[model samples]
Target chain A: MPKLIDFKLILTNIPDLLQYLPITLGIVLLSMVVGLVLALGIALVRLHKIPVLNQIFTVLVSFVRGTPLLVQLYLSYYGVPIALRYWNYYNHTNFNINHVPAFLFVFVAFAINEAAYNSENIRGALLSVDDGEIEAAETLGMTGWQILRRITIPEALVVALPTLGNQFISLIKGTSLAFVAGVIEMTAEGQIIAGRTFRYFEVYLSLAIIYWALTVITEILIRLIEKRINRFRVAQHLVGTPAPTETPIVGAQVLASKEVRS
Target chain B: MITIEHLAKKFDDHQIFSDINLEIQTGEIIGIIGPSGSGKSTLLRCLNLLETPDAGTITIDDQQIVAPHITKAQRLKFRQASTMVFQQFNLFRQKNAWENVAEGLITVKKIPKDEAKARALQELDRVGLAPYANFYPEQLSGGQKQRVAIARSLATDAKLLLLDEPTSALDLELVGEVLQTLKQVVLDHPNFTVILVSHELGFVQEVASRVLFFDDGRIQEAGTPDEVLVHPQHERTKQFLARFATQTVHN
Candidate 1:
């Protein structure tokens, strides 16, 4: 037999990969938190189009999305430090202690970049909301903020969730870029192993499997979320067939109530 | 009372209307009878400022109805004064019928929750939808949806209610329940004003004090129902009434 391809090697690497899991999860979790906050700001800016800021936001969103994310990471790690160094000297070398942390710079780059794309997705979802829905809310006299909280974002999230889920899968792959900034994530650790053992194939294969498992698990979680939000849609179609329509909203409320760990 | 003077609307290449003038006296039901592209829906939408007309003056209860456009703040306040109900029902699918009706009252009027629910219950009772209050709009029939919509409008305490083809989506049997609800509103309320855009001539005659027959986006015939519907001077109005008569015959 062709030397009994060492399944033992794959099994051994599983524990090694597990060690780096927290780092990967941390980057992704941090990126999503920062991205979501920025996206909400950008989304509202574009959606409501608050004066001159709207045009600036559109350009910003377009510029960020139009470029490759890898290039953005490079610009932050290399470019921002140069700006910081100069600004520090201008402030009498007070900033010589590094104005931007490598992790922080990477986080900001990924977050701002993700927010640009997320704002676009979120804006599309918000726009797809029928005018009647908003009108109904306004007529009910839901204050602008209340409507945003009770109806607008809740409904927009349902549409954005799937697209957001896809983006998160991309984010898993994206955390690999954290390796460039020496973040000690899965891919970074994999690189260390590969360099020491000169075992390029094994190390990279382990990295791919870990990323794949994360994406798969995230995908399953997203489906459960989608099923819950789609309760209203399901109920709407069940015409005259005496089954519950409130299931979808109730399910959605349940999901919404579940505290997502930051 | 609502007064619309020389209201003109143009969209893209085609002009919708050039010179339209009308007045809606308080407690009167005005039915706009028109062909498909005659701007009937646009006219109704413009009244509540749902659609922005190019150049016109609208006065609702002497409020000047002018943002000349529906400025966001002005529009919000205007929405409080009037409400439009589409044939589509336009109920929030996420909310139940009672919540849908109570929505505007609690939000716009800033009524307390207990008071809003009480008022919503009263409004629902008026529309004969008290039983379906807890049920969602999705659970109700088309007639029931329209009734809930009426309850929602009533809960807002709006002076003018615009109905866009209200019964067009309902079954023949379902149509009566919705029309009856409106009739009850007309009989009981003294200050309420109604504008109904419908293809149902029999229903229009039963409700409207005055009928304006429209063709090609202009009022072709305008008078009392007896003058416009029965003794139509315009061939278009005669043709329209004939089509409804034929539709009735075929069914």
Candidate 2:
């Protein structure tokens, strides 16, 4: 049997692949920011059940979520240019597809895909927030926007954070599909190097390791955020103190944030 | 003062309550006692426009709103005049006890953070939960959480405070503590009007200035606690009181 494994080649290719890491990370960050904003707007409309628009978004989100992401990428890659051409034709204006970057389609597709899934996660989190709390906020004379900002979003994000982290990790991996739209991200760079060297195993293995490392790092960051957000719970668990009944407040163990203390 | 006239609510075609009329005096603690599904909660919710009534006019303090046609500004003004304490003690999970009390003051009242914190701490002190000011609701008992909610309500200077089954969600052992807290709140603030919906007849009888026996979405009888609880007039009121009487005698 010929040498089936090449550890040295894998090590060499890893450094070469690392150069494109920024592109991969940039795509994930951009898509996540855009996707999260879209998802929140979609989820809010659904939660409020805004007549006809709510129904339309419900169908749109369902249709987006139900379809394969690869198909969506292909649709964007091929469809956007056509749609633009049609728009230009109708208005007798000049617009060109060649001026648009191919990577833009990939970004649009991934963001839409991420949004459809994340909106459900956010909506579930929103619903899980006790109705009683919202009622309390309302009766306190806070407007709907104020309640959403101060109570609903902060609390819902806490519940939705873990799932959102998972979505981001998946989104990072989802960026690999960008190669199909002719966007040379990390995986595409790997493919170009592999094609030249005929080192399929090492290149593919390096890609997998990069993605795994990204996911692990992202998960660790998410855990730290979760811990920070739930600091009171952590403190309670650490103290192991039984809840006191009718005890006069004596010493202050303040968790007061600067904003509150100010 | 709060006044409701010709209040009606319907779920699809089925009526929850219809043509309800009432005038609530300023500073009075009114107890609403009724059978389950008799629309007591619905009636309470309608007062604050939580559940939009199909037809009604609610006048709270200086603001008035016609049912189902309430403008956003009127709704906001009406809500500012009143606050509600939920049975489930709907404390904000993200907030510790003091933060829960301070939230409305800071956000709605536009009080400075330092002042809001002071007011929250004072309200918590009033409810005897000042020691647990930093504790989250999960770390507190049911009664303690309810007291925190009560503190939150008190932090806002709403003229009308609505208590919806305040003690019903508490454990048997914890009920007395919350009931005691509510009693103290009622006695201390005679100028703060309250509409209390409760299943605890004894607590209601003790704290309520007047009791309304509600049946079929209408006030069947309205009088002092002694009149409603001891010397009931309506047949439904008698039947409702008889169950409590049997339970009391059995105990």
Q: State which candidate has the highest lDDT.
A: 2
Worst 10 residues of 2 chain A by lDDT: A234-243
Compute the DockQ of candidate 1: 0.23
lDDT of 2 by residue, A1-262 (tens): 7888998888788889999999888888988999999999989999989999899889989999889888898999999999999999999988888999987998899888888899999999999888888998988888989998998998898899989998998899989989888888999999999899998989999999989999999999999999998775532231224435454444334332322344
Tens-digit per-residue lDDT, B5-110, candidate 2: 9999999887988898999889898999999889999988888778878998988877888879888888887888888989899999888899999999999889
State how far residue B205 of model 1 sits from its true place (Å): 1.2
Native-vs-model 1 lDDT?
0.78
lDDT of 1 by residue, A25-123 (tens): 877888888898888888888878798889988898888988888888887778777887798778876665354457777787888888888888988
Docking class of 1: acceptable
Ten-residue region with minimum lDDT total, candidate 1 chain B: B62-71
Interface RMSD of 2: 4.0
lDDT of 1 at A90: 82
